[model samples]
Target: MGNYQIIATAAMGLEALVAKEVRSLGYECEVENGKVIYSGDESAIARSNLWLRTADRIKIKVGEFKAYTFDELFEKTKALPWEKFLPEDAEFPVIGKSVKSKLFSVSDCQAIVKKAVVERMKKYYKRNSWFEENGAFYRIEIALLKDVATITIDASGQGLHKRGYRIDQGEAPLKETLAAALVMLTNWKADSPFIDPFCGSGTIPIEAAMIGQNIAPGFNREFVSEGWNWISSKVWDDARMEAEDLAKYDQPIDITGTDIDHRMVKIAQENAIEAGFADILQFKQMQVRDISTSKEYGVIVGNPPYGERLGEKKAVEQMYKEMGQAFGKLETWSIYILTSNEEFEQFYGKPATKKRKLFNGFIRTDLYQYWGKKPPRQNEMMK
Candidate 1:
């Protein structure tokens, strides 16, 4: 296992959370706009791929350089030590994106990078003919932002959000990565009751259940890099074992999800069972306004409808007003709501304690937090 630069790409507005997750895994990282970068060996790659809950994907930073021309791009790309990562029969696909750069043609950039990598591989592997590419897959990317080219090989095959448990979902299902972020941002602890009123497909509750149990988001999935020869099977084995050992499977949690749609409730139940939390998580068909809980010091995190489509604004706003009326009475329960609607607080009847801007996919949204009063210390009570 050789030391290499690693990049954990995250959604916009989630770089800090991703960086925090990386650091918690015992690796130092620098948080960028949409990425957290660090250096680590194979174990770092494997562990990050398995443990990073908030990242979109883990990438191995191949090389970065300034490229103003096609020739410069090809030469600099070829100069990187591709042989160290790519085997003789590795299947390398070049995908590219160019932004505010002289190399404005993405297809040309990808083609040039591919040709350059092939040329480099031929020279290093001593091959006369073209590569058979019958072995491990290496999806390479060339990103040019302001004339700087950063190349990386994808380590997580599908996005990390594809936790492989969702057999069904609603029309607008929230990404698991974003769902986990919503849970992590709340004041809810494993011992406290957690609820998602508008839990479409039950993503929030399932993610909360996993978090409450200290389960690795990637524990049940496989990564693209797991097929690479350079990274030993033992590396992945060790990472999995570490995940297994660190999990709090026996921990008790009170998590619930309710949706207005009965079909969505059924789907959520199926997905939870698929995610191995059938008994740990509860789901039901319920409306937001009717949500009444006796549990104090709990947290309510919800991703309600943004009413972005036509004619839905009126109904959604009414629902929001009802949510305000319902949730406002629970003074001991903190509430967090994610919505793109700017008038959310106005309709919800109270201003947020604090607001954090976040993007749900491409839609700009804000997390409106209502902090609840803290629970009294045991000694503060009458003796």
Candidate 2:
């Protein structure tokens, strides 16, 4: 039940979304370049790991201080209360990264931090012999920016984006975190129709289904911190129970995913079934040109090929033109497209209502949004 400083790390350009998710989980946080800073008890650690859909991973901030030299780095790291987090048999591994700092050698920094922690642990636990290192893992990180060292311990073993659903994938698959973010950015309701026209391996549709049904992204996953000695097993159990209690399993959602490649469609179906949405999500092998629906006020989202490779721009742009023409008929349907093409609007034959810059794994892209007419309330419809 000890309180600690927590950090939920996010990918570039997604710090706000991660912060929003942290706030939704009842934690006050400050957004930084690529992480959200907050503080809470053991329950907060478990709960944040279970929630926070867009975060890369959850980390515990152990120490932060200035380090001008190797001795300064080692002494400062040794001075931190490492005994509070690591047990005598803790298998803690130090990973390091240096950016714009005097300690330019990452490997050197990692070695020094590891030695310092071992020294501190030896002093506290009265161990003359070397640590057997055969115990639960505690991955420690030493990140230096401008001579300031920030040390943290990873709580979420793997990244949170590893939702454990997509056993199969295509060549250029979208990350589950980014997929979830795309759905969150839209003005979509659970009851309305949702689609991903360029659904590669069915990531967007599966993510949308999870969000629509109010299911926690980590509902079906395990975290690293569950093995820690200090945190009670009941903390994780209670957090899981909360997730189960909050899920809207009975809520019906109209979600569809289609791709031009039949192989991709099959892969998408397999992934959707694996995600426990076998019956809820529909997948089809269809081209963007053939996409048409009579349903009004639905939402369309796509991460189409950006035509970054040589000699493919003309054909991709032609497809964009056809996609625009086909989608132009559904004036009531909002369209959200993610692409690196600067002239996406020009090719799509319509200006976006709003466009947002988003990074798709180092390839900068824009999320072009077209607002649809808001649907009337059920009571108004009855009237």
Candidate 3:
């Protein structure tokens, strides 16, 4: 348990951000397609499961094999120690995903693995008893890629994006994972003010409040690893204790959110209260053109509606132009807007300093960032 390798799964285009998060957690990581691999001890795994904001889940790769056929898959899966993780009375089920492989039938592979696990457990326990049970302590997923299979034990049962605060979501709600990534992309600190002008459902402000207060994003939920037989109850207790200790920094951080829809503003207020950050954020109903910028320095990060469930293209363009007019007044504030519209820069009246690809679910979007400064010359010296 002292040495382990784990995968921090992330949304599709934010793999690099997930790697950065892993490294920030004081561990070395290798970035791969839609995932980051890192090494740590048991405690580090617990901490990462509790603290990582941009990841979808933390998975423990249990076994790997070159399984091109059902026999090979069964033999390989049966070789692992299944009884060590599952209790004697625990009811387990398997989920399988296969891609670009000879064993492409997902159901077939799933059935094979399930049979292997059951056989191994029966032999290990030396009992001929097997019964169907409704729930289990853990759920396992097997993924097969080009002639290779990897077995992963899910550490976080429900996706980490379900931070347990957003009970009411308006149409086209942005995921909590992407919202946190938007906050981090701003490179914001606790000293700076943060606001989301088009803040729908208050995802941006709640995530900002969590980040500014150094709160662990997973503190409000349960993990599948907590019920595993191999882990001691003391480990979870220590993890919770450490998370509770980390959440003590609750000073006001000047976080605010506003939306044009009064109903959305009320929902945002309710979400903030549910997340226990109502005191740290101010929610209001205001149009984008009426946004006031009294602060000299801050970050405006948000995901505006891009003609998807909101309105037509021309209307959205006009709305964006008004937003640009409002944001142009803040010369000292950096702006990061996530949108699927490529012509957004035309409305903003300035080229973006940087652009990163991000996905709002299946929709392709770009995070356009405008730093409030010009690029320094290559050979220029500091003053």
Candidate 4:
């Protein structure tokens, strides 16, 4: 198969992480503004859609050209070989999203690209087709940055973040992709004990379990490219096989989640069971202040409840103080907390050694990392 350029889209502040994910698949990736551009064939696209845990979507760069005007955009887009990617009777949906550029009209660009693709498609099918699409769909994102239009075809149908395990969602629950990214950002080894004290619906703990097992986040979803005529069934089958084979052995890792609410614990357990890591996780109904365990060399990570939902300022302050006390008890464990409240570090009484900006839905959050004392030199080598 001929080589093709592809773009893996990711959320803001995660370009580096997503680039690592792309490169792990043996693709040459360049981290751009909000996406990673890579060179790969059709198989690579399929593999990424099925295995990338940090990316939002995988898109094939079907066309690229300068589009200062509508005519230019239409002509350049029409030049692409639509027949190669889409069948004669295949249903197509041109989903357009524009960023900073001269040709910034989303509706106009959408119309131009749709018309151009349809015009090119007709030559292959010998029919002037202009009917409402149904069934299968391909989202086309048109990014006109600095007057240069980069047209991409979405290979993944829904976002890769929507791992099917999350059947129950609590208020302000972390997204599966974001949860996975937060864990990956820690660079925690599989041997470390991972725990989430304020796990709401078990996203962080479940994601950690999946990572320790090296399971693909897209293991349960169907990609849009699987329905494309250009992508063969054998190719998809091979991709699935590769993903399954890459899935690492289930290590005897200690992963746990605790929530003040017993109902949340039940939901988390259900999520873990659905994610196929039930045996590796333990969910308990415990408050942050009451957590007493003997696990050493573990990492405590969580998106604790914050803001108005956490009640008045006094209550929130008490929660944060107790969270700090919990961290203090784990003399050899590292703690990573994601919170939107600016006073969180103050309440903890110690500044984070490291920090990163992340988005938890529309609200921006700061992922802070606090480390306890390192283990004795002899203990490190004892293993």
Clashes of each: 0, 0, 0, 0
Instruction: Show the lowest summed lDDT stretch of 10 residues, model 4.
Output: 128-137
lDDT of 2 at 318: 97
In model 3, which regions exceed 4 Å deviation?
131-136, 309-311, 373-382
Across 67-131, the per-residue lDDT of candidate 4 in tens digits comes to: 88899899889999877777655677676766678877888898899898888877777886564
Deviation of model 3 at 331, angstroms: 0.7
Per-candidate TM-scores read 0.98, 0.97, 0.94, 0.94
lDDT, model 2, position 111: 96
Q: How far in Å is the alpha carbon of 168 misplaced in model 2? A: 0.4
lDDT of each: 0.94, 0.94, 0.85, 0.84
lDDT string, candidate 3, 289-379, tens digits: 8987778678899798887654588888888899888888888788999999999999878789899988999999999998864225522
User: RMSD in Å for candidate 1, one decimal?
Assistant: 1.8
Summing lDDT over every window of 10 consecutive residues in candidate 1, give the lowest-scoring window.
374-383
> What's the lDDT for candidate 2?
0.94
lDDT of 2 by residue, 1-383 (tens): 79999999988889999999999999899999989999999999998988888999999999999999999999999999999999889999989899999999999999999999999999999988799989989999999999999999999999999999998999999999999999999989998899899998999999999999999999898999999998989999999999999999999999999999999999999998889999999999899999999999899999999998999999999999999999999988999999999999999999999999899999999999988776677438877
Q: What lDDT is reached at residue 286 by model 2? A: 90
Q: How does model 4 score by TM-score?
A: 0.94
- How many steric overlaps does candidate 4 have? 0
